[model samples]
Target: MKFSAERATLLKALAHIQSVAEKRNTIPILANVLIHAADGQLSLKATDMEIEVVEVIPATIKREGATTAPAAVLYEIVRKLPDNVLVELDQADGDTPLQLRADRYATRLNVLSVDDFPSMGAGELPCRFKLNAGVLRSLIDRTRFAISTEETRYYLNGIFFHAADADGVPLLRAVATDGHRLARVETDLPEGAAEMPGVIIPRKTVAELRKLIDEAPEEIEVALSETRVQFTAGSIMLTSKLIDGTFPEYDRVIPRNNNRILRVGKKDFSDAVARVAAISQERSRPVKLTLEPGLLTLSASSPEQGVAKEELDDNRISYDAESLEIGFQARYLNDITDQVEKEVEFAFSDSAAPTIVRDVDSPSALYVLMPMRV
Candidate 1:
């Protein structure tokens, strides 16, 4: 393959592609990126079996050919090259090393057989839709923090995406949970997405997708099947295999009739929780909340570190519920509250039952936290 591409453009594309390639792989080809040059464009592709990313950029093509080279090495070389300098890549055949040249720097990267690079064939994607980049970012940012890191319950290790009806209105929803806490966010369903099947987008895919969309254009094209999903953002295309497992019926865990409503300033509550939690040395980092008419008290205790407490009065909080004390992991509380802006509403059932939380400003998003015994 032979092509010349601008250093800045090539480096940006390589940054996205190399992240998908595994640094250490039993199959050597899996650690390399497939570089194809043809038709006035250069296509770079990398995959780690479960996820694949491809980026195309305008390049001066001298010959139409393809080869595989170390993805990390290529990215580093181009990234360190002088800015705005044109980068030239050339290879005579699959057996020869790929030559990389800039203004004054040159290096040869060992090439692998392009035929050995695996492709994650996107079978038939029946459901397709277009979502605004801002909306997609909102969906991921609000819920991904709750995605499970536990390996045994693979089903809970991703965000569950599906179409649902909220009061006869079709809505696209994203839900994630790690057993201790759950986050659910929804938006108006996009066109052509009403019949899409429920799918669990793996954590890694969500993370990579989030990074790409940060610089993506205003709109993103999404296509999905029962087993796979693909996202297209301008010249970058990402295809990932859906986690083959059934997510639990999450609605059953959401408390509906909590009735005891407590509203507090987001900053005040978060800061108090952080301060009190600093005293607890356990992994759970338990923080206890004591609630009463017009007042809320936050406290945490450790046998070795002593105890800490903070109080928010009616001025900063509004609570008319009868006396109630609830225990929760401080980190989990912060994670849910971080998504809220201005004020946070807490609906409590009892100290023993799950507590419902929401952003007073956004009705489309809801959270449930399982109380930790303090």
Candidate 2:
């Protein structure tokens, strides 16, 4: 196999594909990246059996062939090469090492048979759609913070993605929860997404997909099946296996009649909660929120440390019930409020009931926080 590509082009392709290869693997070939040179393009593929990423870059090909090389080692070498330099790869035989040459540096990287690399065949994807990069990023950033980290309840360790109707209009929804708090966000369903099945995308896949969308492409192509999903951004493609588990029915956990309303600036509420929680214990870090007609006070106390209290004037705050005091983990509040824009509205039924938080300007996202007994 022989191919030549620009330093920058090869580096970018390697950066995207090498991350899918696990650093430590029991199988030797699993830690290697498969490189195929054919028809004026160089294709790089890496996988950990569960998730696979492939990137193709335009290259000048003198011979059509394929080889496997250590992914991390090759990435490091390419990253340190001089800018704009042309990199040349040559493998004379199938069993011999691959020769890598760039300017004055020359090295022979060990090679494995390309046939040993696992094949993640492209299955028939029944559902295909196109979504704007900005929309996909918003849906992930707004709800990923609430995804559960517990491995026992694997179903809760990812964001539940599905199509649902809100007020007679169809929308695509993403929901994640860790029992303490829940985040739900919705966006307009893409044209071809009506038949998309509800899938629980694993946390790792969500993180990787987030990286691809961070640069903000104009649009992303998504193909989905019952057990897997594939995302294509330009010349790069990511394929991941869906988590085989049923997600809990999250609608029941959302409060329906919590009418006690309190509207406050998102920044102010977040800042006050952080300040009060500073004196809280390391374990629980519980902060108390006291609501009244026109004032909201946040307080936190620790027997071993000290107490903190802060009061904010909220003209929109209103509650018919006697002054209600509720306790919650301060970190959870910050996580929810940080994702909100402009003002945040809170609805509560009682001290023991769950509190619902929403952004006044954007009703598509909602958060539910279960109160703690302090």
Candidate 3:
């Protein structure tokens, strides 16, 4: 196989696909990326069994053939090559190593037969839809932080994506939770996605998709089936097997009648929480929020480190309760506030009930945090 490609173009494609290949592999072929040169294009593929990424870039093909080489090594070689130079890859015989040549560099990398590469299965998708890249990016960003890292409750390890009705209006929603906290974001349903099945997009797949759509690609084509989900944008396609599990009914946990509403500046609340929690126990990092008619105070204490406290402007906050004190992990408070750009509304029933947090202006995104016992 022989082909030539521009240094910058080739490097970008290789850099993105190589990340899918694991460095230490029980199976040798898993460490190599499949390179196929044909039809005036070079296709690079890398997979770690669960997720696969395929990228195609325009290249000059002198011979149509395929081979596999160490993904990381090839990427480094292409990245270090002089910009704008043409990189040539040649393999004259089936038993010969792949030859790479740049302006002043030349080397042969051991190659594995392309037939050894794992096959990516993308079943026929009954639901295919097109969504604006910006919209999809927003949905993922809002909920990804709450995805569970726990391995036992595998269902919560990724974002739960499905179609739901919000106030009689159909909307596409992404929900994630780790028991202690939950995040839910919703957007208008894309055309042709009415029947899309609920799917748990694995954490790794969500991360890869985030990278691909970060540049704000104009539109993304999404195809979904019972077992897998595929996304295509520009010259790249990512396919992954969905987690086979049922997500709990999270709506039941979202507080609906917690009317003790308190509005506070997001930055103020976040900073206060961080300061008070500085003296909190290492294990829990617990911060207590004490709310009253016209004052809100945050405090934390550790037997060995003493205690810390902070008081915010009562004018910016409002609460209907006579008085209530709730405890939460300081890190969780920071995470929920980091996603908000303006004021935050905290709705609580009592010190022992789950507190609901929301951006005052963004009704589409909501966070539910269970109180930590102090």
All candidates' TM-scores? 0.99, 0.95, 0.97
Better of 2 and 3 by TM-score: 3
Deviation from truth (RMSD, Å), model 1:
0.8
- Backbone clash total, candidate 1: 0
How does each model score on lDDT? 0.94, 0.90, 0.90
Better of 1 and 3 by lDDT: 1
> Which order, best to worst by TM-score?
1, 3, 2
lDDT of 2 by residue, 1-374 (tens): 89999999999888877788878878889889999999889999999888899988899999999999999999999999999899999999899999999999999999888899998765888999999999999999999999999999999999999999988999999999999899999999999999899999989999989988875369999999989999998888999999999999999999899878888888888988888888855857789999877789899998888889999864534444557898888888889999888889888988899999999899989999999997
Give one clash count per candidate, in the order shown: 0, 0, 0
Best by lDDT: 1
222: Cα error in model 3, Å: 0.4
lDDT by residue (tens digit), candidate 1, 1-374: 78999999999999999998998878788899999999999999999999999999999999999999999989988888888899999998879999999998988989888888898999999999999999999999999999999999999999999999988999999999999999999999999999999999999999999999988999999999999999999999999999999999999999878999999999999999999998866768789999999999999999898999999999999999899988999999999999999999999999899999999999999999999887
Residue 128, model 2: lDDT of 97
Candidate 2 lDDT at 316 equals: 36
